[model samples]
Target: MALTAFVCGCTGNDRSQPQAVVILGAASTKDLLSDIAEAASNSLDRPVEIEISTGPSHALAQQILSGAPADLYVSANRQWAEAVVDADLAEPAVDWLSNALVVVVPADPTVAVDRLEDLASESVKRVAIAGENVPAGIYAQQALSYYQLWEPLSASGKIIRGHDVRSTLAYAERGEVDAAIVYATDARLTDGVRVIARLDPASHSPIVYSLVRLHGESPAADAVYQFFVGDEARHIAERYGFQAFSVSQDEE
Candidate 1:
C-alpha cells in the first residue's frame, strides 16, 4: 500500500508541473516580453513557464517554417508574420505594436558626426546595419534610398551587416562601427550608444509589429496569447517605447 501511494503521489506531482509556452519573438522585444510573461504567469495563477527564443524577426519566421515548435510568434514587422500566416503555420497575425528607427553612435565620440548626412563624411567609415532580410535593414535601405545615399554608401564598402538589430546595436555600442541604424527602442535600451537622428516616418514604410498564434492548439498557448493581447501587456509594451496596436477597450 505504501509503495502504491508513493507512486501515485509522484505521478500527481509530475502532472501538476507547469506547461511551457515557447515564444519566439524579435530580439527588440526581449526585455519587454519577459516582463509581460512573468506578470501574466502571476495573474493567471497557471503553471506556465514561458520559454522565449529571440532573434531577427525574419530568422524566427524561418525557424517556424522549418518545423520549430513555437507556441507564439511576435515579429518586428508584419511582412515576416504574413509569411508564417500565408504558409498556414499560423492564423492571421494581428498588429501588436509600432516603432520607429534611429541612427546611433557610440556614447564617446570618435568624430563630431551627428546627422544622417554625416554618414557620408570621411570621419564616419563603417556603419553597422542588419541584414536586408531583417525589417530594420529593409527600413534602413528604404530610408537611405529615399535620401539618394544608398547606392553611394553601398559603393563605399563601409556597410557592416549584422544578422539582427541587436547585433547592429552591439557593433555601435562597442564602437565597432562609426554608426548604426537601429530601432529607437533599441537605442533607449543601451546607454553605450547615443541616438543621433531619428528617421523621418515618410522615409520608409510605417513600422508595425505583429503577433500570431502558431498551430498546435494547446491551452497554455491560448492563455499566453490572451495575456499578451490584454491591457496589462499593452501598458508594459508602451513603457518600453512601443505604441499600442489599437485594441478596443471591450477587447481588453
Candidate 2:
C-alpha cells in the first residue's frame, strides 16, 4: 500500500482548529485503520483529521525514533513496538490484534506449490517474503524453519526478499515469484492472488499487533486511540480478517 492519508470528519473553510492526528501503522493495517479512523471521526464530537502512514513495522519504529511526526504507532509485532517504548518514544505497547500466515500463489496458478512442502520442489523457482527484519518475514522464517525448509531454500537462492508484506504479496500477485508468505488478512484484500495453505500458528511466534500512544497529549488522538481499542474497532478489525486480541484470548 502506498503511504496515503485520509481526512475524516468535516473538511472545508470551517477549519476551526481541526485536531490533526498522525498515525504510523503497519502496512497490512492500512485499510482497516482507515475504516476505524472514519468511524472515529463520525462518533467523536470534535472534528479530527487523521493522516495514516504505513510501512514495515521495524522501519516505522525507526522513523518514530528519528522524530517522525506520529501521535500513535501501531506495529505488526511486539518486538518493534517495544523498541519504541524502550527508546522512550512512546508509552508501553498493548496487544490489539492477531493474524495468521498464509502461502499464496498467483490467481492463475502458474506454480505447482499447493502445499508448504511444494516450495522445495524443483518447479518452484522463487518465493517472496518480507525482509528479515520485518515482522512478516520473521514469522515466515520461523514457519519455514519449523518445516525444515528454510536452510535448503536459502541455500538455493530461491528466497526473494521484499521491503514489507504488501510488497511481498505483490511478488506473487504479479507472478514475479512462484509464491509468497504473507498475512491472511493481506491475501483477503487482493484478488490477484490465491491462498493455498495457512501456516500453523504453533509454527511461529504469535502474530500480535501492538499499539502505543506516542509521548504526547492530543484529545483527538486520544479519542481515536480509545475508539481503536474499543469494541467498535474490534468488530471492524474482524471484518478485515484480523483477530482481536480479546477474541484470541477467549479462544484460548
Candidate 3:
C-alpha cells in the first residue's frame, strides 16, 4: 500500500511554532490511530499537532530504521517492533493491542466459504491476502499452514497478494476475490463482506500490536504516548475491535 500521512489538529492560521508528535502505525491501525489522535489532541492542554503515517508494518519499520521522523511507532506484530528496538531506534516495545484473523467473503450469500478447508475447493476461485512480509499475511499463512492448506492454496495459484490488510479486505469487499483473510477489526469496517470463519488463535503466533516510544524528548510526544496507553484509549481501541493489552499483564 502507498504510505499515507495525515496531519491532525492543524489550524488554518499559520502558526509560528506548534508542538508536533509524529506517529508511524501499521495500516490495520490507521482508523484506530486517527481516532486516538483526535482524542489526544482534544485532551491535551497545549496545541499539539499530531501527524500519522501508516502502511504495512514491515514497511513502516524499514522507514523508521532509515531515519524517518517518528516519535511513536505502533507495529502490527512484535517482530518489526523488536527490530526497531534492536536497532536502538526506540525503546523496548510494549504489546499494546491484539487482533484476530478471519476468512471473509462478499456479503452475497452465493459466495460462500464456510470453513478453512473450503478455501481449497474450486468454488472459491481467488483468495486475497496481504504480502507475506505484512503481519496480517504472516498470521494468515501461519493459520493456513497449521490447517495444512497453504501449500495446496499456493500450488493452485488462487492466492492474490495485497499490499496490506486493508487492501486485502478491499479485494473481497469489491468482489474482486472470492474470499479474503483479514483482521476481524477490518472485516467489521465494511458491510460488503461477511465473515465466514475466525482463525483459531492457537493456530498462529500471538497477534500483538506492539508500541514503541522512539527516542525523543518532546513533551508532546510523551503526552501522546501516555494517552495511547491510558484508559480512554483502551476504550477507543475496543470499539474498533482491538483488545487492549494491559501494561500490568505485560509486566507480570
Q: CA lDDT of each candidate?
A: 0.84, 0.90, 0.88
For candidate 3, give the lDDT: 0.88
Task: Estimate, for each residue in 55-75, the C-alpha lDDT of model 3 and write its tens digit.
Answer: 999999998899988899999
Report backbone clashes per prediction: 0, 0, 0
Q: Which candidate comes out best when scored by TM-score?
A: 2
Error of 1 at 34 (Å): 0.8
Worst 10 residues of 1 by lDDT: 1-10
Q: Is candidate 1 or 3 superior in TM-score?
A: 3
RMSD of each: 7.3, 3.2, 2.8
C-alpha positional error of residue 101 in candidate 3 after TM-score superposition, expressed in Å: 0.6
| Residue-level lDDT tens digits of model 2 in 1-252 | 448777678754556777899999999998998999888888877888899898999999998889988998999999999999999887678899999999999998776778889999999989999999999999999999999999999999999999999999999989999999999999999999999999999999999999888889788888888888888999999999999966232321
Please give, for residues 1-252, the per-residue lDDT of candidate 1 as tens digits.
000000011122234777778888888888887888877777664567778778889989998999998889989899999999999998778888999989999999687767999999877789888999999999999998898878888999889998889899999999889999999999999899989899998999989999888988688778888889989999999999999886653432
Clashing pairs in 1: none
Alpha-carbon runs more than 4 Å astray in model 1? 1-15, 248-252
